[model samples]
Target: MFLAATTAGDRVRANPGGQAFCPSCMADLIPKCGEIKVWHWAHRTDDCDPWSEPESQWHIDWKTRFGLQNCEVVMGPHRADVVARDGLVIELQHSHISPEEIAERQRFYRRMIWVVDAGEFREHVDLRLASIRTDPYRQQPTTYRSFRWRWPRPTHARFTSPLFWDFGDGTMLNVRKIHPETPCGGWGYLWTKPQFVRRFAVHVDELGDALEDGATA
Candidate 1:
């Protein structure tokens, strides 16, 4: 967790030896201001949220983008990475997670959004995108649903917010507009299908605007 609550119920970033408490568990938190990594708060004992993942520089960078508005927010019994004032819970995921876990989180945070780092899957995504570009379905309006990728499952159709895929580059791909399709002969299998559009590709800095637009829509 990056932000902890002071005794006065104010949110604060931990400094070495500073007194802080977890907003969810109310356990003592220690400030880790080491020279090696970004300054953050950690539980003195065990963390209440077992699902919490280790943070990376990429995760830190994304959280910093929210400034003070993005804090470790307590949702239900767990703490979310960032909960904006607009009631959007932003989860910055950099590692591979099980589909069950993803589903669980989505169910738990009803209005949550995901920002997945595709740095490791760049080559795969590139190939998929290239293939999508030349796909015959790309030219037809009705067949647009056939353009898809593998990672962002089309089965997660219930997710209201767009899943943002960040390749650690300047651009991001919005996977929310994609629709899932099952082949007629296949036995109830969801396939990756996306609607290819130049506008769906956006700059990293424009994420805030995108979220606002998505919220309104």
Candidate 2:
């Protein structure tokens, strides 16, 4: 967790010699400031939530973007990675996650957005995004198949929210209005069918105006 509660009930980041406790479990948290990894608090015992994944530099960097104040929000029985001031939960997913897990998180945090690392799929995403940017009018809509099992897909239409797929190189694809159609049978079933999905894409750099408009809504 990025933010831990001090004895005085104040939220603090991990620092040398600082003592903290998990906001959810209330267990003693040890501040790990090793040079190899990002500084963060760890449970002194084996009481930490199993669902919490090990934090990577990418995850830490993204969390820092929102600042510590908006990081590690305790909601019900789970702690969200980051919660915006407007009550939007921003979940940054770096590693592979199960579809079931994705559905659960969306169900738990109804008002949320997912920032997923495209990782290996980054190249495909970038190419498609470039095509959209180069000739949006001509391209209209482009579809790309997801061969990687870890890649997230639109499970349901009702869970419609902007999903920012980060390429980890400062490029991001904002996808919305996702509709997952019937799967293509035969050998094509081996991979996720691009034709079965319909989504609108926009570059993150071009999202400033849209985001500003959304803030008002």
TM-score of 2: 0.65
lDDT of 2 by residue, 1-217 (tens): 6678988879998899988889988888999889988888888776465557667777776665555666777887788887764677888787667777877888888988777776666543313222213223124343332322223244423334556666555445454434345341111011111111112112333334323322121
lDDT of 1 by residue, 110-183 (tens): 88777778677655432232222322322322211223444544444544445766756544554435444542
Best-matching candidate per TM-score: 2
User: Where's the lowest-lDDT run of ten residues in candidate 2?
Assistant: 184-193
Question: Which residue pairs clash within candidate 1?
Answer: 147-194
Question: Cα deviation in Å at residue 138, candidate 1?
Answer: 20
In terms of lDDT, model 1 sits at 0.58
lDDT score, candidate 2, position 96: 67
lDDT of 2: 0.58
Report the Cα RMSD per candidate: 8.4, 9.1
